[model samples]
Structure formats: C-alpha cells, structure tokens
Target: MVETMRRRGSSKGRALDLIRSQGPISRVELAEITGLTQATISNLVRELLADGVVSETGRGESSGGKPRMRLEINPASRFGVGVDLGADSSTFVVADLAGTIIGRLGIDGPGALGPADYVRRMADDLAHLLDGLDIDRAAVVGLGIAAPGPIDREAGVIVGAPSLAAWSEFPLTAELSRLTGFSCVLDNDATAAALGEFWLGATEVGSTYASVYMGTGIGAGIVFDGTVYRGSRSNVGELGHVSVDARGPECPCGNRGCVELYAGPHAVIARAREAAASGGIDLEFTGVAAADFAAVAEAAITGHPLALALIEDSAEYLAEAIVSLVNIIDLDHLVLAGSAFEKVGAIYVRTIQHIVGERALSRHLQHVSVRMSVNGTDAAALGAATMVLQEQLSPRSLQSVTLA
Candidate 1:
C-alpha cells in the first residue's frame, strides 16, 4: 500500500510538471508524453482538477470524434516567493504557479548586519509583502533565496560570498524556513537567473544555453539538456574569475586579469569616473556608483563618444570571455541579464554578437545567438521563485540547479 501511494505521488508530480511546462495539453498528449495508459492520465487529471491544481481550458480538435478537453496548471492554486539577495539591496518577488510575478518589494540588504538580523529583516519584508496581497498564505508552497555564492546547497548554508561575508557559514535556508513558516531553498544568483530564463524565458525545452549575469560581479549559469550543469561542488560557472588578460591587474581571487575586473558594473563605473575626472568627457558625475553607471549608460545610448567608448570597452572584454566559454561549452545561445544590463544592454548584446560571430571556434559550424533576458533585472528573483516550484512540483532533483 505504501509503495502504491509513493508511485501515485510520483506520477502526480510528473503530470503537474507536464502541465506547467506544456499546458493546454490533452490527456491523450499527457499519456503520449508520459507513456502512461489513458486510464492513468484520466485518473491523474481528475485528481489534479479536484485539487484545483489544474483547470480545463477550452477544447482541441479531435481526430474523428468529439473535441478533446485541454488542461493547464491553475495559476492561482499556489504561490512562491523568490528573493534576490544582493550586495547592496535585496529584491523580493511573489509569483503564481504559472511563474508570473504578482507582487514585489525591495529592501536594503545585509551590508553590516549579522546573520540573525538579516534573516529577521528578510522574514519581516516577506511577511509584509504577503500580507498586503489578496492571495491565500496557506497556498504559498515555499520560498527560494538567490544569493551570491560559493554555497553549500545540500546543507542549505551560505558557505562563502565575497561581498556578503556576514552570511558565510550561515544556515540561511533553515533560518528562512523557521522565520517564514514555509520550506525554503537556496541557490546562487547566476544559477537562479539561468533557471529563470529556462523556465520563463524564450529558450526551447532541451536546449543548451548560458546566461551571463552582470551585476555587482559577473558570472555565468549554464543549462544543458534541460538541467542546470552545476559543477561538482555547485561552484561552477564563475566566469568572472576567468582570465582574459595575462598581464592585467590582480584579482582578489589571486588571479591576474579576471574578466570581472574589466567588465563588471563596478569596473565600468570606475572607468567612467576616471574619464569624467580627466575632463575629456563633459558628463555629470554622481558620487553613487550605480547612479554614475546609469548616467554613463544613458550617455552611451545617446551617442556620447567617451561614454560609448567606456561601455564598448567593457563589452569587448565580456565578449572575449564569452567567445572562450562558447568554444569550450559548444553553446549556441547566450543570454545577458541582471541589474547592470538594465540600461544600454543593447550595446553589450551587439558587441558580444559581433565578436562571437567573428571569432568563435565553431563559427563555421553554427551561428551563435545573443539576446537580453526578458525579465531583465528581475531574472534572478523570478528564477528563485521557479526553484521553489521545481522543488515542490517537479520530479527532477534541484541538485542540478547550480552554477555550472
């Protein structure tokens, strides 16, 4: 009896995942996809419908008889919270079962605060966001937090983060779960962004791609064969530390000429500040680095030569790293995402496309495609939400949802 129940639960999870991934599908299609009998599909669909997990849409054309009823995951059946914990700020988002953001909030991050205080603040913000919404709190399945890593995902601990030192060795997932009274999951920001693109962006199922996340730092999230290619320790895809120049400046990671030093937002803003100080560029300087980067991005978009030069220079370094990555991974599609790409993303897109097209090792074999993320700055947060959905509803293990 126990074995039968477990099997049924597994089948139910699979059926729900199918609806979420390729919904508006008929029972016949589900049976075909799952290799289950028509009776099993009917039984599963009936249970899902009764549970409010799925709803019948209209009907599809039939072969010879009556039209078949189409079914989809009910968007209102459940909710998930995703948090992007950044160096300077944290973004909180609430998403429905359909992976749509229904509400969002942002607050200052744990810059100087200890682990306990940071967790309390996050829980309070999450509670406030949920309380303000009209949805049922009981329907919330879980919370997913995306933070900068080297994380100990299995242990649910933030092992280390360069900027967020106070969070290191912190039991982030357990603390969040305790404070929020919901199960919680933890993932690196870049990996979450990659999964977000795969789950919600335009990528086709079973396609191999990489999302290069450029925020305070640079990293890549690699998804191959419908799963994130998290390396052995889940610390893969640290593309920022990839060496682009042998004789360039030293990196904190004990490397010379890491790509992040040249292409990260901080680097771009630092260069912009230097340019403004040189009196060659007639742009106003905001002491705030993020604001300064935004001004420089605006200038670049408006055809200012100096600002354009700074952006293009950053893009060039990024492109070089991308070319090397593509050659190694044999990837054909690349996504640029994160807060840094919120403005003047097109310039980076164009530069990366041009360089990859011209210099990729497989240029003669296939054309590489580069595009901006649909979710833009919110990709990580959205991906974090998707992680919760995947963990709760999907059959696949999220152990694969890591950096590689």
Candidate 2:
C-alpha cells in the first residue's frame, strides 16, 4: 500500500511538470510521455481541472475517432507579480499561469532607498499599472522578486547588499506582502535570470546549463538536471565574487578583484567615459542604457575604437569567469544575458565561446555552446515574471524575483 501511495505522489508531480511545460495536451499524450495509464492521467487531469489549475482548451483533431479534448493551464485562475529590483531601478511585471505578461511598469530609483520605501513604492507603482489594465486584484497569485544578494531565502530578507546598502537585512518578502496583500518569493537576480532562460530559452544541448547575467552587476544561475541549484543557504552561482585579478580595484563586497567590479555595467561605462574624456569628446554616456546596448555593440563592430576597447576589456573578464564556471560545472551550454551583454553581446559570446571551446575540460569530447539569452534587454523583468509562473505552476522549485 505504501509503495502504491509513493507511486501515486510521484505521478502527480510528473503530471504537474509536464502540464506546466506542455499543457493544452490530451490524455493520450500525457499518458504516452509520462508512462502512466490513461485512466491515471485522466484522474490526475480531472483533479487538477477541478482545483481550477487546469482548463479545457478547445479540442484536437482525431485520428479517425472522437476528437480529443485539450487541457491547458488555467491562466486566469491564478495570477502572479514579478519584480526585478536593482541598484539603478526596479521593474514590475504581472503574468498569468501561461507565462504571458499581462502588464508591466519600470521606474528609476536610487539603491539608497530603504527596503520599506522601495517596497511601498513598488506596491504603489504595481497597483497603478494593474489599475490601468483593469485587472482584478484577487486574481494575483503571488509576488516574485529578483534582487541582488546575499539573500536569506527562508526569512525572505536581504542579508547584505553592498550594491544597495539600505536593503541590508530588509524583510523584503514579508513587508512587501503586507503592503501588497500578496504572497512573495525572493531570489537572487542572476538566479532569477537563469530560471527565466530555462523556462523560455530553447536549446538542443544537455539540460545542465549556466546563465551568466551582465548588468549593473555580474551574477549567474545554474540550471542542473532541470532544476535550479541553490546551494546551502539558497545562494549559489555567485560568479561576481570570483576573483580574476587579486590586485584589481577594491570591490564593495570586500573583495579586492571580483569579476563584477571588472566586467559589469559599471566597468564598461566607466571605461567608455574615461576614453571619451581622455579624447576630449564630451558624449552622453546615457546611451549605455539596456535599450541601446545593441546599437552600441554595432558601433563597436564597425571599428569604433573606444567602444571596441571597452567591450573587449569587459568581455575578457566575463569570459574568464564563465570559463572557470564551465570547467567546474561542465555545463554543456552557457547563455549571455542582461543589459550589459546587449551592448557588447556578440563580443561576449565570441570571447566566452572561444575560451570555453578551446580551454574547458569538457572540450575534450563535446564543445560547450555559448549563446546570448533569448530575453534580450527585457530579460530580467520578463524572467521576474516567469518567477511568478514557476511558483504558481511548479511549486516544487523555489521562486526568484520577490517584491522588494
């Protein structure tokens, strides 16, 4: 009897994952893929449907028999809110169960703001956006926050964020939940970006992969065996702290030479500004925004010396970190993501791919594929939304991107 019960529980878990990923599928398909009986699939689907987690979505063509009924996630049955909070700004995105973004808003705010002020402002901003969209308040499932580290995942607090000082020890999830009346999940920004790519990016390689995020900071998310690998204390894949130069600039994290301090947005912008100033060329560095990184990259490609130099320097550090990670984890694939990458993404991809393919231990047999993220400039925010979807659909895995 105990064996049977265990089997049943396992089947239900499989059903949930399969349906979450490829729902709008029929009973036959679910049975075939899951190796469960048709009757079992039907029973599980019915249970999910009755609980309002799944819904009937029209019908599929039949093979000389009755048409099969399609079942999909009930997106309207539950909703979620995703927020990407950074030192430079915050972005909120609302998505349904189907991972479709319903509404979004972005704002500029200094990282010096207290957690309470930031959460309250985010709540207010999100409310305004939802109100404009005429969405029902009760439909929101939970809040997912993508924040900088280090994080206390269980306590839902920001342990220490040097990049954003006021956020230290902030009760982000609980406080934000109180302000917004929605449950919240908090995770590291890079971890959240990796989840976003895992759920959204397509690849023919092995499931184990790394998502290297280049933004105001450098962070990475490791997707291992189809699950995010959060180490003890729910913090892992912190590539920013990986030292590439022991005698480089002092980092806010107390490290003398971390990858982030050398390769993140700050590094690139600082380099660009220095070059411009040295050449007596007063140009607007505001063009370094995420929305314009691609254009900057194009200019660099055309032999723009300053742009190319800055991008090359950043890419070198980035590639160094990624190569180290690949050697350790042996990830079959790597994704370059975030606003920083959008500007010099090709340079990053080329550098990382070349280094990994040439020097990684895994290169002895199979080459590690390095590519840009599918999310583009909006990836962090979009992945922030996917965090909500992950929570609502696959509660087995923890969510990234919390409210504060």
Candidate 3:
C-alpha cells in the first residue's frame, strides 16, 4: 500500500520478510538467516530504519558481549485494507505492519448481483468502514481483495470462476482502485488465507504447508519459505475443481465429479434440503448458502442423524481431494479455514485426518497435522489484508498514494 510501492526479489525485501517472520531478531540473526555479511545486513537495516519500516524492540540476552538490540516491524508505520467477497458476506479489515487487525467489518455477500453492482456496493461499505475506524487514513497504503478464482492477478479480474460467473472478465482491481482512490490488488481467497496464516497465524517459518479453505467453493493456498506460491495462472489453489470421477455431475469449471460438486457447502446444503423435503430431519433453511450450511453443521453437532450423515459425506468427499493434495504437494501441515468449517469443523477434520493418515503417500515419511485456522471465518479476509504488508515489506517504488 505505501503509495504504490512494489518491491520483490530484492535483498532489502528479503531482509524485511525475515524481520516480519522472525523478529524481534537482531542484525546478526538476520545476516545468519539470509547468509548476507554483517556489513550488508547493517546497510539494509539502516535503509529500513530510515524508511520507518522497523524499530528496535528491546535488548536481547547477552551471549558474551553487551546485549544485542532486538528488532521488529514497526506496527504503526503502515496499514492495509483487505476485503473478502464471499457468496454469503463480504469481510473488510485494516491491519498494520505487525499483522494485527485494528478494525473489521462484515456485510451482505454478492448474492445474485453482477460485478458492477457488487463492486459498487462493496466500495460504499469500505468507505463507511474506514470512516469509523480510529486509524490514520494517510497511513493506509493499499487495498487487497480475496475472492473466488481463477483470477488474473496480473490483470486484476476474475477469469473463469464458475461460482462468480457474472464477475468473469471484469476488471475489479481497476474499478475498486478508481472508486476508493487506493491502489488495489487481488488474489484467490484460499491463497490469501494461506498468506494470512503466514503473515499472522502461528506457523513454523520455512515449513512447507497448505491451507484448505471452504467458502462458496473449496480451494487451497500453499506457502513454502514464507512466500505464497503462484502457479502459472496466479491461481495455484483450485482444489475444488479437481475431478474425482470422470462420469459424475459436471461442474461449471468444465469438469465432472469435481470435489466441490460433491462436498462444497452448496452441495451439502442441497442434500440437507432434499432430506427435509422427504419428511426427514428438518433443519432451518435460509436462502443464504453460508447460513444454511451452518444450520446443517449445527444439526449434525447436536446428533441429527441425517445432518450428521450429510456433513460426514461431505467430509469423506473432501478427504479424497485432500489426500491427493497431500501427495501432490507433500504437505505436512494443513489448516481448515473459511465459513463452512466454523460449526462442524471437527467432523471434517476427523474424516480428513483418518483418510489422509491412512491413504496419503507421505504417511510413511511424515504425519500430516490437520487443524482449524485460529482466524476461523476471518482467515481469508485477514490474509487479504496481509497482502499489503507483504508488498510494503519489499517495495520497489516510492510513489505516494491517496485515498478518497
């Protein structure tokens, strides 16, 4: 955000990424981690200090000589905006350099609106949200969006997301930037969740892991050595679209028997509603997919046989996709993130654990740890905000940006 700055793959950027991940650390530790000489580390640290990007937190314990000055990201130096556009609701958050969310807001989701209407309403909500949070608007650098994919991250538009069909080919970043007067960037929600986990969630640095997110559709985001991996399409984590059966129901993403077809919130809710229609265990139905799915999960948790069966069925289907993901990425840690997991996450976790534990190819080499995101439903939104922190930590330019 810091006024249109984007620095990547630079020595200074590397130093900053390390500082955020591994600080209150010392320059000596930075040098050791980066393998840069002490002199070079001092130079980079000086530049960062001059930019107000870092500060000395305190003195660390002495080994032999005087205590070393501990360093960390200056939380007050910059702030970022993150917006998660979901089928049920949109989440907005503002986070500072240290990865703490200072403010958050949630509003109705896209529903049936086309891109134009949705973006217009979203921008209005964002303006309202910022006006109320007690933060310096001038300190806000840029905006980040977490949305359904496959997105053209370079182009700032949804390319071919079946769930967001109306948004395909729409230049969301350009329009949002114009409306808010803040430079904007967009990424897949699941990918953003993974990065959010990296930026704010407690995870081992340099460890290879993946976050499987279930929102309107299922997806995943992978991180290795603290950077989110963007495949050729900048849409690396479309796990939902992965086909499990060649002859099953066709998905809008041009596949048959996709994971989402059998296991996504929409499918699970549809199944629950069908059971209710047949004089089965009735659960409350809301037109909103996320809310309705939550009802089903709640029913399952409370011992409704039909609800439990439906949720477990979704879990089993997801395990098939996830076991394959474990083998493909060789992932050792997995986070279940997003709205669908909030109510009955343990069921999905239990099912996935059993399947992955027994069927994963890497089961012999390592054990996969399955857990829920501490951020819960806010994972994608928080991850969206952290995108700004990532950009500022490695900025390449110094242009000033203004907000409306």
After superposition on all CA atoms, what RMSD does each candidate show versus the true structure? 2.3, 4.1, 5.0
lDDT of 3 by residue, 297-348 (tens): 8899999999999999999999999998999888869999999999999999
Best by TM-score: 1
Best by lDDT: 1
The TM-score between candidate 3 and the true structure equals: 0.92
User: What C-alpha lDDT, on a 0 to 100 scale, does residue 380 get in candidate 1?
Assistant: 93
Ranked candidates, highest lDDT first: 1, 3, 2
Query: How close to the true structure is residue 342 of candidate 2, measured as C-alpha lDDT?
Result: 63
Using Cα atoms with residue i matched to residue i, what is each candidate's TM-score against the true structure? 0.93, 0.88, 0.92
User: At residue 231, what lDDT does model 2 achieve?
Assistant: 77
Q: Looking at candidate 3, what is the lDDT of residue 328?
A: 89
Per-residue lDDT over 1-404 for candidate 1, one digit per residue giving the tens place of the 0 to 100 score: 99898788778888888888888899999999989899998998999899888999999987999999999989989888999988778899999888899999988767678889988999998888998997687899899988877788778887757767777888889988999999998887899998888777468776789989887888888898777887877777888899998999998877999998998777888887787788867777655555677888888888899888989999999999999999999996999988888888999999999999999999999988999998889999999998898778764533374442
Pick by lDDT: 1 or 2, better one: 1
- Return the lDDT, model 1, position 360: 98
Report the Cα lDDT for candidate 1.
0.86
Model 3 global lDDT (CA atoms, 0 to 1): 0.85
